[model samples]
Target: MQQSITPQHEHEHHESMKVFGFWIFLMTDCILFACLFATFAVLRTHTDSPFTGNELFEIPGFTAETFILLTSSFTSGLATLAMNKGKVKPLIGWLAVTVLLGAAFIGLEINEFMKMVSEGATISTNAFLSSFYTLVSTHGLHVSVGIVWMIAIMIQLKKHGIQSVTKRKVQVMSLYWHFLDVVWIFLFTVVYLMGVM
Candidate 1:
């Protein structure tokens, strides 16, 4: 006789599929960011701007942003850990912390952009600045999306507590958070650290 699927089994299948689909999505995002990074590399020097990345980028500010983002990644992991343990409060608390850190990171990025603009490094100034803005701001946009997503998840967690669905959602968000942080590491090294060198 053929085995009939139970509701729990069906949900389990759906949960696995959700994670698998998200991985596929992340892979496509990887391709998109790779193209952006390549474009940035090619245009890093084709500039008419008065200042280069070395002169324009402040180490302390970007360093702080990196630290905050990396810390938030850790906090996100903690949230996931809490969820796996069936604890709702800690998961929500960690998500809240992650949101604050993400907001701070975005704030620093905007400040950096504004400072550059004030100093004559506008997007239209040159190919280099244009590429820089495009690559970095693309990452910023992703982080902003992540912040919004996390907030929405937090609301769901509040209403539903730690159900199977909520757990999977948290897992997906945590993965996305880490993915953004990994991309930022490359961006910091490629765009800022290398620039200052």
Candidate 2:
């Protein structure tokens, strides 16, 4: 007799493997971020520079950016819920909202960086500035990549509707969005809050 696999069993196996793979990838990314954060933390308060976080970081601007990102995360969650119910219109709308929110966050961050640079706080100014730019900009780059990924998925959804494969992709992207949000929370606490203090 030949062995047979049921559809339900196959789906469960695939999902389990996907979750495991995602977790592993997340852990590796965490390690990379940890190194960057550690470097920044060590150099953040270096007194060799005329410019410092107190002079460079505008708390109101960072607060707005944080709000935009957090709101985007919530919209991404709503998008995922809409996708699960096979409601394409609401899903697309929510995703569009998320994209807009993400774009807004990026815009604010860029403006803040420009202001700092104009005030003589370029990344090359000192070790503190360099590490600060690297750590925070790395996170910004990730958010930009996530936005591009979201747009690609939106296109895929339009072409394929809500098939199993598309559903799985959305599920994974949702996890990615949430992961980014969690990372931002830590970045805000560690980099922004600590720098101000």
Candidate 3:
């Protein structure tokens, strides 16, 4: 005879499935970034404009952006840790810090993009600019989505407290935040460091 499924088991099963589904989404995102990277690589050398990565890329600004995003990832982890301990205030506090850092990173990126555009290095300026804008902007969009998602989760946590559902959401958001940090590391190395060199 088949055993009856308990409520605890049902909850656990759903939680595990949510985590598994998030992993699949991340894998697809990895593939998407890979394709974007390949496109950027291929088209980066095909510039018709005077503005190139070597000329336009600012090392210090992107470096600071990297620092802010990486710190946000760390704070995201702290938020997860706080959730695991069932501390609502600290969890929310950590998430607030993470959101602030995320916003700062996005602000800096937009500033950089505006600077480039002012220098006539727009997407229409060349294939390189087109691909560069596409790839970097896509990553920025992801971070923006994550920030919004984190805020929504914060509201849920405040209303519901640290239930299994909120816990899973924190876990998923933490994972997504870390993934963005990893992607930015690559973007920094490939698009900025190598470009400047």
Candidate 4:
């Protein structure tokens, strides 16, 4: 004989299932980033020609990029909190801030890359430079895509208000934004700090 679940129990089960699925997704993303980092690590020391991290990395530029992304993560978190409170205006405002910060981060990244290329650190200069560009630029590309996604979600939130679907979307965005921040932390440590050392 099968036992029936109470309404409360059913809701709890659903929530648990959703959280479990989200955690699995996050783990998969972590694995993906791990592989990327490993590839970058292996390629970072391949200085067959000119254009090494010491020659290419600008501390001030990367510092600004890091701050922008970190602040965006904060704003995205605040947006999620505001949404939980059912406050639409603050949620939208925070999400807008997140989007702006994300855009600024990408802009700084692109500017840094352009500056490096102007200084002759083209990707073909060496395997190290190639991997450096690929790794960092790939992260920047992800930030750009996240900004676009945030804008679309913001529009939908504005039009529909914070319904269950919108709330779920915002929660997912929060997870993604935080995940990006985590990736950046690793990148900063591995690429920037390790390179300088």
lDDT of 4: 0.83
Model 1 C-alpha lDDT per residue in residues 1-197, reported as the tens digit of each score: 13565777888899989999999999999999999999999989886545799889999999999999999999999999999999999999999999999999999999999999999898888899989999999999999999999999999999999998988999999999999999999999999999999
Task: Residues 70-153, candidate 4: write the lDDT tens digits.
Answer: 888998999999999999999999999999899888878778888888988888888788777777877777778788889999
Who is ahead in lDDT, 1 or 3?
1
- Candidate 3 wrongly placed segments (more than 4 Å): 1-5
Model 3 agreement with the true structure over 1-197: per-residue lDDT tens digits: 13466877888999999999999999999999999999999987887536778899998999999999989999999999988888999999999999999999999999999999998888888888899999999999999999999999999999999998889989999999999999999999988998888
Pull out the clashing pairs in model 1.
none
**TM match of model 4 to true structure:** 0.88
The number of residue pairs in model 2 that clash at the backbone is 0
Candidate 3, lDDT over the whole model = 0.93
- Cα shift from native, residue 54, model 2 (Å): 1.1
Rank list by lDDT: 1, 3, 2, 4
- Comparing 2 with 4 on lDDT, the higher-scoring candidate is 2
CA-only RMSD, every prediction: 1.8, 2.1, 2.0, 3.1
Looking at candidate 4, what is the lDDT of residue 188? 88
Clashing pairs in 3: none
Q: On a 0 to 1 TM-score scale, where does candidate 3 land against the true structure?
A: 0.96
Between prediction 1 and prediction 2, which has the larger TM-score? 1
- Please list the residue runs of candidate 2 whose C-alpha ends up more than 4 Å from where it truly belongs after superposition: 1-5
lDDT per residue as tens, model 2, 1-197: 12456776788678768877887888898898999989988888774645877666788999898899999999999999998888998998898999899999999999989988998888888889899899999999989998999999999999999877788788888788888888899989988887777
